[model samples]
Target: MRYVVGITMDKRGRDAVSLALTLAQSTLTSHPVELDLVHVIRGVPPEQAVSKPEREFQKLCLEEAQQWMAKTHDLIPKTIHSTTSVHFSDSMATGLIDKATERPCDLIVVGAASHGPLRRFTVGSVANALLHSSPVSVALAPSGYLPPSRLTRLTCALGMRPGAEVALNVATQSSVLHDVPLRLISLIAFDARSGAAETTDAASDHAKKLLVRASQSVDNATEVMVDVAHGRSIESAIDTLTWDEGEIVLIGSNRLARRQSIFLGTTANKMLRSLPVPMVVVPRFPAPESTADDDISI
Candidate 1:
């Protein structure tokens, strides 16, 4: 698998690169993996030449980007493979998307916006834009976060929707590839009409059934578990669950304007707003030709 990591001359950007390396090493142990470290100079046109002052500014930006890229490269272990490149564009988000598409990377990894008590897990403008526009999967690493020692668990936020099955399949594959356990979670917000207890029961029942089918789709050696969280709001439901340091969440992307673009649904968006750990937003896979007979909803 190939991963494109967005780099800037900052600590947060370096954190993203570190997380990307961790993922590549953990998930692609048997297969060859590549990481492309990319830095984009925003507000600069790729085709146009700049004046003397602007040229000097561009030179400084490139020099800074190169230094950061070099420092990041030194941190990577000798076993892992990586390359660095710089790009010029009017928008950083669009430039990242274009670069990833050109490489045809499987995933795009980026850092959180900035470091602050309130913005620790908050997505930055560039990352938020990529989440909506990128064609490939996008992974967000929290600010000041170091890669976990091991990726032992994959927690998937399962939904009863058309694209959810795709997310499950991706999660299952990741679990099998990394030799980890998979947890299929469904968060049900309390509805005034449905009642809390009833909603929780129904969601739990559906989740168990979905887990059974999802497990059968993956390797028999892969272990799958299911859980249902209920609360007044999505954030509350997610907060109720306990998370491991090595666990990562996978949620299906919901696209509206583009057929296969990466867009978060209401619930997914809320979860990202106060994300507890690193999260990967999996793009909806194309529908299969034949439908199988199964009772699972997600």
Candidate 2:
């Protein structure tokens, strides 16, 4: 799998790099994992003409970007193949989208917005743009997140929605590739207006049926666990579950998304605010199947 990781000269940038490496290394597939470390020079197109002084300033900026890239390059170990480049575009998100499209990468990784609690995600402007516009899946690293030796588990948030299959497919692929366990969770948030026992029982029964259907679709060899989490709200339901240090969550894009593009709904945005681990937003449609040599690019 090839990944396009957005790089900046801040803590967020380092956090992104850390998560990308952890993800790349965890996959034990025959196909090699490659990372394209990219930094964008926003509001500056490469071909635009300018005065001599302005040109000099742009050159200096490019130099600084290259230096930063070099430092990031050193952080990557020999086990993983990586490349660094600086692109000029109107916006950081635009540059990243362009780069990912050019490479036809499998995933794009970025750090959460600053000013959030450590180990939690806060969507920033660039992440918001990608979630709404990018054609590929996007991964967001929590603030101050530092990946463990490698990922140990993949938890897919399953719902009785149209795009749920997409999330399961991606999570299963990752689980099989990494040889890790996969957990399927159904969040049931009860209301005060209803009979608590009846509401809980009905929701639990439906959630269990969904879990059975989902589990039957998986390979028998895969270790799967299913649960129905109940709470007053989605956030509280998620809090009731224990999270592992090396765990990553997978969630599907909204059903209202374009055929294969991503659109983060209100529920997902809320979950993002409370999630303690890194989250991957799967697109509405499954990625096209291809061999490593044919479709995978730098």
Candidate 3:
């Protein structure tokens, strides 16, 4: 599988690159994996139009991108073959999507956006746009996150819906490939409009059945565990659960949306707001057919 790490001349971007490298090394042991480090240079304003200052600014951006590439190259292990590229475009999100489409990468890694007074790692503009439009899966690295020494577990946020099986399959495959344990988790939010006790009981029962069926499909080498979180909201429910380091959460796209479209449901979006660890958004199976030109250049 080919993985592209979107980098910028900043700390968050470097963290994203490092996390991507860690994932590549851990999961691609059996297959050939190629890592591409990319930096997108937003096009200077046309209003500036050929002015000396505009020209100098463009040159400075290119120089900084190159320097970042060099620093990334030094951080990579010699065993992992990699390449670095720069894209010049008007939109950072579009440029990255184009680059991923051109490489046909299976996954794209980026850093969570830091904003607001607290500077919490929220889903930034680029990631938010990609979540809906990207042709492939996207992974978000939290602010100041360092790659774990190893991938200890993959937790699937099973929704007990039609498309949720896609996420289960991904989590199962990752566990088998990386030889890590697999966990199936379902969250049941307490709805005030409904009978809370009955709803919770039904949801818990459904989650247990889903996990049983899911566990049967996995290989013997992979260990499977199950849990269900229940509370007033998705966030509150998730907070009640215990999480360890070296764990990643996998979420499936919406089932009713267009095929292969990355549709983040309400639960998935809520989970992203306070994701404790890295999160991997899994698209639907049988990726949508693309007639659009793939040879996009920045």
RMSD of each: 4.2, 2.8, 4.6
**Model 2: per-residue Cα lDDT over 13-52, one tens digit each:** 8989999988898877586789999999875643463777
Task: Report the lDDT tens digits of candidate 3 across residue range 1-298.
Answer: 6778888777768768767876777864566567888888898643454888888888887888888788887888887878898888877778888887884577888888755112135877888888887767788887777778988888889876687776776677677776778888888886678688887777778778877766776747778988878888999998898876788888888775567667777888998876688888867753433213321100
Instruction: Give the residue spans of candidate 1 off by over 4 A.
Output: 45-47, 116-120, 191-193, 255-257, 286-298
TM-score of each: 0.90, 0.92, 0.88
Number of the predicted model whose TM-score against the real structure is largest = 2
Model 2 RMSD to the real structure? 2.8
Output candidate 1 Cα RMSD: 4.2
Q: Rate the local accuracy (lDDT) of all candidates.
A: 0.76, 0.82, 0.75
Residue pairs clashing, model 3: none
Error of 2 at 151 (Å): 1.1
Total residue pair clashes for candidate 3: 0
lDDT of 1: 0.76
